[model samples]
Target: MKTVNLELFNNPNTVNKLSIAIKNESEKLNKPIKIMHICGTHENSIVRYGIRDLLPKSITVIAGPGCPVCVTSSKDIDAVINLSLKKNVKILTFGDMLKVPGTEMSFYKAKSLGADIKMVYSVFDAIELARSASKPCIFFACGFETTAAPTASALRDINIPDNFFIYSAHKYTPNGVYALLKSGKINMDGLILPGHASAISGLKVYERFVEDFNIPCASAGFESVDVLLSVLLIIKQINNKKPKIENGYKRVVNYEGNKNAQKALEDIFYLTNAVWRGLGNIDLTGYELRKEYARFDAKKQFDIVYSDNYIEHQKGCRCNEVILGNINPTQCPLYAKLCTPQNPVGPCMVSDEGTCKNWYDGGIE
Candidate 1:
């Protein structure tokens, strides 16, 4: 059982006070402040609870490449989709991956065309699936450090069935933010660190970003109050000219993070250059299976083929810009016209944590 926060930070009066503080702090700031957060679940909380609507107009909240499914390159998606098309091979994935765009089609579209694609919630499920499956099964794993740690743990403890293979698309969370800021893709005043992912990877990992950019960061939990408090803290930091890493969700996140989880990652995977859908390639940003675990890697074993073409995001889709904080989803020409959850033209719309999906579902004005 997990302990729940009883803080009434979301209380009408509490939120009202925080809102007042933000407005007052906004008035003290030199210019408009853009605070970027890179977590789909955090974005969901912000939109679902109307947190954006309560903030000062001068303060802007934007999202980065936090959603793992949204950042998956088209070539990777196409490769996995292609792998699913083969006989006696089923591609196991999360529900979100079903609708994500590949070359010209998606896994769901492939499944409709008779591709064997199975959706699983956890890696253990894939192991169980392999135990009973009559044919070869591959787990198309995708996520940040949080999900990666669990996958690593599963691989370390369980002897994967011969029919089981893994297609890893796991990424490191803080590294994504570092790449975004280093490349000048996202021009922001502060950062809202992901609580869940950071809980596994730790807050210390963000020390480099804070030192290099002098940006204020607060590891935030998924709650309206948590986000509101973080917003206030960031505003205070900017006003005081103090750039430091603060833990807004101190109950779960700590200075060091989860040690055992980190150990699993160190043992099972190694850092390497990874290509993001909209963000392009960033060095030491991706997690690949280690040499000892080569037998579990699906790409090497299957000899899968996919074009190296740079056809990642759709030309008209502003998902690339949205992730970089260059533009909003509404600013895109095809946002609601040609793209929606049911019939998505890009990965941003297909993923629930995607900026476009949250905006569309939350109906942000």
Candidate 2:
């Protein structure tokens, strides 16, 4: 049991050396390379530290569908809101989900109008709150594997209250990335995989990306040197034409990931085609509670029906394009003007891990 030296990862001298190595590697190919990292935290680190500015002109780092809050479809938001308002169900969610604009209204707005939406820190909080509550409690479960694994573990290990249920908007990152690449919506030479999610899912799930798409993938941590080192690894892989899934954040992420967490996820839920906010529906990306876990599933227990036609982004909000890495926040007309932290016009403006929010906070321009 040893303490991690946080300073070692962010050491200026170490970061400078990594950046130099990235530059040298980029110079070897002398060709434009687009590397997309599908993680909100990675985007925050990149923008917060001005990682893009440190890169060579030939290399471009863009964000993909990373933020769970940003990608949680409006239909799901509307469903949860409907449950709170119409059915008189008590809703529990993360603070970030409160501000995310839904089809008709947001959770914050819903709460203002007498909806019982309580923000909790985790699934355990929701479970504890439901234990004593008379009314049905529905947890608006949102996130990728990192968060989903915990939710699965809670339901499996804990003596969950019978009144508690989950409306899952959880997604599988590997399949989502795969579907995005298959659709030809994004064209990138390499990918910087998510660290936290990969820690739960492992690098093995991403081997298909290298095998089929011939893309170099590196799992990265949320630090200046870690990002730069991941970039260097991808660049080297591209230069050598050796595309494979490499672990840049080796301390946290492993090749097979956490077996217990994986088992919990497999035992609790199954993969299905779920809708992403701006990016329509991707196959086998969303999670649904298994038949055995029906009592704990809000969609099944409450007989919830999701609408086909739902408003994803507000008018003039380019959140969909932003999620796809097709455009940056500055490209949106409502970015800083109509969409601020205090008052967000789109889903991307709401969450901390969101690209637009990170860009606004960083204000790189």
TM-score of each: 0.97, 0.98
Error of 2 at 273 (Å): 1.1
Per-residue lDDT tens digits of candidate 1, residues 209-305?
8899999998888878889889989999999999899999988999999999999999999989888987788888789999899899997889688
Clashing pairs in 2: none
Model 1 lDDT-worst window of ten: 3-12
Which runs in model 1 stand beyond 4 Å of their true positions?
5-9
In the range 1-365, model 2's lDDT, one tens digit per residue, is 86678789999899888888888878899579899999999999998888999998999999998999999999999977977888878999999999999988899999999999999999999999999999999999999999999999999999998899999999999999898898998778899999999999999999999988999999999989899989999999999989998999998999999999999999999999999888998999999999999889888888676787789988899999999898989999999898998899999988999999999999743
Q: Model 1: clashing residue pairs?
A: none
Total clashes for model 2: 0
Off by over 4 Å in 2: none
Q: Can you give the lDDT of residue 33 in candidate 2? A: 86
